[model samples]
Target: MPLPLYLLAVAVFAMGTSEFMLAGLLPDIASDLDVSVGTAGMLTSAFAIGMIVGAPLVAALARNWPRRSSLLGFTLAFAAAHAVGSSTTSFPLLFATRVVAALANAGFLAVALTAAAALVAPDKKGRALAVLLSGTTVATIAGVPGGSALGALLGWRAAFWAVAALCLPTALGILKGIPAGRAREQTIGGAALRAELAQLAMPRLILVMLLGALVNAATFAGLTFLAPVVTGTAGLSELWVSVALVLFGIGSFVGATIAGRLSDRNPGAVIAVGGPLLLIGWPALAVLADEPVALLLLVFVQGALSFALGSTLITRVLYEAAGASTMAGSYATAALNVGAAVGPLIAAAALNTGAGSLGPVWSSGFLIAIALLIAFPFRAMIRADSNTEVLQ
Candidate 1:
């Protein structure tokens, strides 16, 4: 709703592109750096590890800083990381840059989540968050594909340079848009930090964060291996892999749009409806992996359901953590990246066990089932919250 929110989303777009575009450039990077593709793939693992560790750490360290300055610092740091990465021929240097970039990206996201919520009315927080997350969905649709094409036309370094260049305008936008203030009225100190960390042990907050992580794990499990599923299982051409990804991205965008509107009114309903659909969808995807038409259709449906449910869970984490001094956004960010890391690990294990391309689908189903079971007790709480909102 606000211009600043859009600017934050634009910054997220640049960061999100860097996060995913590397998937397409891994082969080139490996070749240039005199490493195997598998080794280059560790760059992704390094980024994930950075995000998981950096979110809360960075948020706590920057808790007392002016929000605008912290945001600008992270954004510029991200751009610089990419610039160094683009110039590097050493694998270790490039790997270190990815970690640096991921830390900057994590800090930016953690701060931006709180900042976006701060910029909006209480009732509009869901929509504001959705606007911010739309940047990632759009990156999946346009930025990753464009970066891949650039890498194909020029070189892998070109994609990194492009991401760095894009961040320039994003940094400028952040400088212009975000207001100078701490995330909260009360600044965090030693005791405050300990208290905020203590909040992580709260049962309600832990449940919500776990739900968010499980939902995200299920999502990435299927998505990380979707290309192989499309080609190896469905017998499609390489071009069709891109088409399937686009379809999934489109579905995610649409699902997130709907979730944003509905989450504020009734987050329970979003989860209630989406959770069962995903439970059914994942198994169906596994069974239909060999059917081109069915696989394509299910991919879209699964994406929509998974993201709709995932977004709602994230909103719930924000709600549950709202009382934390400064760790609310960091908690959500950490939960998200934890899922991002764990999901693919599980899927990869399944594949290694001779499960073939359908391994991820089955793995997703297993994860979603656990998520649904975990969410069962939360229904009463969610409904009570919804009722209170309606009464207010």
Candidate 2:
């Protein structure tokens, strides 16, 4: 509801768009570079790796900087990344640009979330997160499919270029709308962040972050391979497959909106529901649906549920650490990015091997199961702590 939230959303929109658009660009990227699809897939891998590497480092480096300056600097870096990524000809150069984007991506999220949390009241912190995440959700619908069309008509470079164009205006909006001084991070906050982590490291909340990362890892692993899953396994045409992805994006966007609201009411339920739907959706792709409509429905539900509780989980971490909120938030962000890196690498390997097209589904089902298992013993602890109004 605040102006800063909307400013963050614009930045998030560009970030989310760049992140998801690469999937749709893979074929074009592969063809242009004369590489295998598996090889071209490195773009996704590179980005995740960048995120995993950049998140904590960026947080630590920007620890002394004001949040506004951190984000402003982050935006400039992100805009450059898109420009480089869009214009590069060689694969290695493009890969480097992706890494740049990834670094900027992680930094943007880490900084933005901290800022978003700072902007809102303590009670409605979850909704503030939801507003930021809404940009990402909307990206699934607006960015991924739009990028696909951009690649189709003008080449994948065009998609990146469009993303680059989005950056300028977004940066301007952030500058204009956000309170210049208020948007910055603090030096004491950084030292405080470290101290908070040391003092308030709640085991149960840690478990949730770890588990959340793992569950989402499976989703990423499968998500990265969705085009093949649709076209190869489902026996759909490429064009139709793109259309299906568009629908999936639509579903994910809606799911994210619902999850945002649900975080206030029932984050636990939102997460719990995502797991089962994903379990069903995973096997369903192997033959869960017979009709085209049925197939689309299944995939849509899968995407929606898979990422359903992303903001809720973040909110929980922040909720648990009332005093050391930034540290808790940073750790959770780092964990998720680590999962993003690890999940797809493992999944790509699975799909590349003879494990079948359903490799990601199995990975996701197993990861979600693992995450759930890890979180089981801590559920009561978490509930107790949430009731306590502090995590650590």
User: Which candidate has the top score in lDDT?
Assistant: 1
Please tell me which predicted candidate would have the highest TM-score against the true structure. Answer: 2
What's the lDDT for all of these models? 0.80, 0.71
Error of 1 at 222 (Å): 1.6
Per-prediction TM-score to the true structure, in the order listed? 0.83, 0.85
| Colliding residue pairs in candidate 2 | 66-184, 66-185, 67-184, 67-185, 68-183, 68-184, 284-288, 320-391
Per-residue accuracy of model 1 over 20-62 as CA lDDT, tens digit each: 6665566567678897644565676677778999999988876
Model 1 lDDT, residue 38, Cα: 44
Q: Cα deviation in Å at residue 291, candidate 2?
A: 5.4
Backbone clashes in candidate 2 total 8
Model 2 per-residue lDDT tens digits across residues 1-392 = 78768877877887888877766667678889898766776677788778878876776665555666767777888888878877777889988988898888878787777677777777788788878877877788877778777787788888888887777765775676554453334445546656776734667667667766786687677677666666666677656656766787887777766876776556677667766666667676656533567777777877777667555676565665566644555666666766777777777667766656667666777777777777666656444233534323
